[model samples]
Target chain A: MSNITNQSLSEILESIKSKKISSLELTQAYIKNIENAKKLNAFVTTTFDQALENAKKFDNKPNNEQLLSGVPLAVKDLFCTENVKTMAGSNILNNFVPSYESTVTKNLWNNGAFLLGKLNCDEFAMGSSNETSFFGNVINPIGDHLVPGGSSGGSSSALAADLTPATIGTDTGGSIRQPASFTGTVGLKPTYGLCSRWGIVAFASSLDQAGPMTKTVNDCSIMLEAMSGFDEKDSTSINKKKETYSKNLKDNIKGLKIGIPKEYRVDNMPKEIDELWEKGKKILKDLGAQLIDISLPHTKYALPTYYIVAPAEASSNLARYDGVRYGYRSQKGKDLIEMYENTRSEGFGDEVKRRILIGTYVLSSGYYDAYYLKAQKVRQLIKKDFDDSFTKVDAILTPSTPSSAFKIGEKTNDPVSMYLNDIFTVPVNLAGLPALSLPAGLDKQGYPLGLQLIGKALDEQKILNIGYAFEKNCGYKNEIKKWWS
Target chain B: MSLDKEKIKHVAKLARISVDEAKVDSLTKDLNSIFKFIEQLNELNTDKVEPLTSILNQSLRSRKDEISDGKIREKILKNSPKKNEEFFVVPKVIE
Candidate 1:
């Protein structure tokens, strides 16, 4: 079990298929790892009993053709797991257990994956750090006090610590990528409509996309292949045949033109991150992939534009939590209006409340055109910046974040400073393109640094291929002392 | 302050969240700084660009208006904090 916990998802699947290890054995190993790694606060709920039961059932009758038979995986709490507490790291939905399963999780289970548990995340997926969660902040497995990133912080932490073989995380604005970058794991935010969002708690409807967070590039590709497809329930879901992403991971990146956006060269970027970016470029160049200078001119405006668009949509989407249908309700309120207000004020965290207020203000009558619409127009320009650049290159390369994982309380107090964490990752979300973040090197502090590969919309296979080539060169792996144990 | 007290109060009301009077001062400051930060976007010339609501550039895929989903009334009601046999119980609204 000790040796098995260190194996990749692909290795686990192969081992299970060959009967070298039973699904129940693997499940128990992960459950033990999760039990031991509790200090990281990676999971909001651990469905160990249910996972073991499912694993036993699968072991009793092995399924040869199933993609990930009996593989234990965790999902970010934002994805609604049937009969499981889907808190989304908010007290409002702390007791809310969905009777339905999110489309992404359902797909994973359908492909013979067993659920380890629901992972912790930012409250309503709002903040850049896991500190905003109603549950306490998730500690990075790399360092004791450092954050594991957010809102998919728990997903990344668990994957990095080997608590789960693979996990699912949703990226609204760099949530998945940044955390993966910080934790030295692989995370992909697939194209906006590539995966269905049904049953996943809405953060920003237009920006939310679910993808796989895994221990390796091949595992990420395979998990994405299982989790993606069209569902009529999600109107935005694209109607396309499911792709075998793992089969398409051709390590030949030769003749591929990778674009390096000049806007990513910020004035105050840490030297280590810059050096890692350079190392990433050199790796690609050595592999025969041409690096070209490109400009995403509207990149500077992405953060502000995201702030407006995301919160505006969030305010509308969250309007349902009014002490009426589901979630927490105020007990002291005497009347309907008071009940609504009291329930929300008490249920929402500070960051959630702040964003909702901003959203409400911007979408309010006189300010709608000035703030919301203005931001949308700028969002178009940001999208155009990428659209134009894609014609010259096959994919874009950049650092995943400005820095590696920071201490828990470092940026929590400063909202503006915290928003800058998503500086490199947000523009990709704005343009609705697929991006993968994989470990390129370690920072001076010994925490992992990640480099990103941004692909043209629906070009996930291309980026994964390039990522596979780079991943081979770096030989980067998540190695941590048994601190939490 | 970028947004005055009345404006903050109005926004809070619009958002349906009651703000504590004590927190409003801090909330105002936070919103002000955020608004000021976002004001940087005003410098960008977006006069010719159309508002991009959806990034996919794909039009809404509408289907026949039919009852494709149902039979989950019990499941829907199960999540409500307070619910009767079929309906959720909320505070009285009628006079």
Candidate 2:
């Protein structure tokens, strides 16, 4: 059953279809695993009875043909799940339950995917580590002491710990990829507008994208097929035809051109990561793909530009949480102003408050031109860098994160250090490109390292195909940490 | 680009959040440091550079100005802290 740790969605569904495993029994098994793995803190809430009831309904249906029928999956807390407490890892939303479901979650339910429960995340999906969550930090199931990357930390950790077969996570700036890298799992951030943002608790309107996190790239393809579609509710949702993402998994990659970004080979990168990247390039080369040198010279500006743009939009999006509206409101306030102040002050965590402050300052009247406008211009250059590079190569490659997972509390105090963690992954978000982080190898400390593949806008299929090719060639499956097993 | 204590307090107020006086000092220092780092952007010659808003330069699609169907008033008001029979209640704003 431990080999069930990384089963693809199709395999799991086949077992259920043949009556080899009952949906109730499968959900029960996952529930049992989650119960025993409580130390990992992978789940914020688990709806066992609800999930079982839903599974029983599916069991009775004789003619259901949904692709993800009876598959149990966890949702990141950022998406609004109707009637469930969808707190985006903050005290402010502690009591908030949406009356309507987020489009992504609703689509998943429509496809017959069982909703296990919501997972933990950083407050408003702001931090790179799970430590900022109001529900308490999630521990990496692979190792007890290492931090699970965030704001999708719980989703990644839950999948890694085998609490769920697959999970859905949203990425804006490296939320999905960074944590996926840390947990040695497959995480995909699809092109912007590929998934609707109507009910997603907005972090940054322009950058937020919902994607899948699973144990294998094949599972990611299956989950992505179910999660993505056009929605009239979201103005930015692209009206593109849908296709099976895993249809071309067996496609050949011979004569494929993979771009290796020169700028990502910065002087400050750790030596082990550099060597692993070289090894990854060689593996691709030996697998009949050609490596082409590319340049994204504006790479150094990605972190600064992202910080300014994301926070500015976050400040605006979070303004909806004033005391009068839905969410936690202060009980002992004398007046409306005091109520507003007290509610937000007590509800939001430190990191959220810090971002809100920075956001407000940058978008303020006098500083808007100096900071926000400048960052916007730099954003154009960053996108241009990718545009120019894509003209030369099919996809761009770089180390997902500069280093492996850092110890908890290592860079929490220094905000700059924390922001640097997303340096390589942010540019892709800026350009609205599709990127996937696949485990390449392990660092000296035995911590997992990830190599990122970035494709052009709306080219998610290509990135997944490339990731599939790499997975086949590498055949690299390290043993899950003893604790997870 | 140095943010003083007063500027930090003002920014916090503008953001509608409260900050402790002691914490304000550290926030000022941190904001100043970040701003100084961002000052590197000033070195690039961007006189003719246009600010990019969206990744694709395509224009936003416009729908006809017609009333459609969406009025979840009850659902929207369900989570409000203070609400009346048909509307959300709040403290008086005007004297």
Candidate 3:
């Protein structure tokens, strides 16, 4: 049963084209899977009728050349969908439906991708585990009680559970990649501005980037092609000419130089993870790629610096959700100030409030120079570490997470422990580099371990090519099928 | 790096968030512990390092200052708490 679940997106598309199955039937199958796997809590909202109608439209359309035509995909609930409730996993947005669609969702639909549903997530994309979501936590597909990481936990779980062929997820500080690692799927966080952020419920505006979550690297490449482009409406959108991302998948990796960062292999890393890194190195070396030892010495400082910078930006971006304009308003308020305070206090989850407060403190006049400005300087040094390493290596490889998925509620009580889960993935975001997580091997507990590939900005194709080649060689895809059954 | 109850209250107010009196003591303890941990960054030698506001070193490209579709009245109003025919409604502040 898991065998069929592990089929690549390209194979599914071919099966649809040969009339072996219709898009409507495929959508129905996934929707049925979602219903059967309800205990996983992978989805926050399911659009059964809209998905069926869209699949029917795909059948009637004369053109079928689009790469993702008829593919059933789940969108993280953070993205706004027209007439559908986009909750961002918070009660404040429980009943709020945007009349306009997010640019990413609109692009997917325009490219013939069908929406399966909106997946669950951390409230406003704030937590490392799925536990903070207003909707109940999403469980890992492989183990019923284990966590699917967040804030894109639902997207990762859906892909892992065979509920969808692919999904769109937003990554601000490992929201996408960390969860993908937890669930043993492929997740990409393209260079910031590669994908338009217009209509995405803002979390940390400067750091947020959206990408695809799928069972294979090639599937992610195809989905990324459909999702990325320049947009006039988004101020941060890059103005580069559009190009096909999947075109470089078959490129040779024989001479590729992969860098192993000494700093990442720190004293605190578990022995199993260290062994996994060694295994990854051996595999790459066997493929005729050169391995070079490099140093990102500033790595330890990245986590602390990101906490300051991301929260500072988030504090400002989340300010728009006041009671008067939109979203939740407290009923007990007697005046405007009371209403504003009461609404946010009641509407936001504890983590969101914590971040807003931390952000406000760092950005305050007295401490701005000491905390926020200092963190920014460290951010530059962090980017330089990667920049200096890239000069010596064609690409960099690291474990996607410090360890595999932990059980739900294991670290929820301690925010610091939860933040450490993204320690390896955050620096890639801070540098605005393209990175992805590919299933490497299984840990002792049978949960999947993911190996990450980091590339120079706009060199996403290089990393995808390397990952696709690794997938072909490693063949972890077969093991995934067993979990589905 | 120790966050006192007074500091937590002041920060919450600056962020426009209201914390009940009972919660302030707990928040202070939590913030203090977190800040104490993060204060390890102070030990790093970053004297000459330049601050990076954005990873992209290039200047942002400016778009033409022409309005295309500046209005989405109906769509924007869909999430509004209180709205008249043409504008959102808020409490009057004028005396």
TM-score of chain A for each candidate?
0.99, 0.97, 0.97
Write the candidate numbers in order of decreasing TM-score. 1, 2, 3
Local accuracy of candidate 3 as per-residue lDDT tens digits, A157-178: 8888888888989999999899
As for candidate 2, its interface RMSD to one decimal place is 1.5
How high is the CA lDDT of each candidate model? 0.92, 0.86, 0.86
Best by TM-score: 1
Q: How would the candidate models be sorted by DockQ, starting from the highest? A: 1, 3, 2
Real A-B contacts recovered, model 2: 0.53
lDDT string, candidate 1, A1-485, tens digits: 56898889999999999999999999899888888988999898989899989999998888869888888888899999989989999999989989888898999999999788989999999987899999989999899989999989999899888898899899999999999999999999999999999999999999999999998899999999999999989999998888899988889999999999999999889999889999999999999999999999999999999999999999999998987788999897789899999999999999999999999999999899899999999999999999899999999999999999999899977898999999999998888999999998898789999999999999999999999999998888778887989
Q: In model 1, how large is the Cα lDDT of residue A195?
A: 96
Q: Candidate 3 chain B TM?
A: 0.88
List interface RMSDs for the candidates, in order. 0.8, 1.5, 1.4
Better of 1 and 2 by DockQ: 1
TM-score of each: 0.99, 0.97, 0.97
Which of the CAPRI classes, incorrect, acceptable, medium or high, describes model 1? high
Give candidate 1's chain B TM-score: 0.91
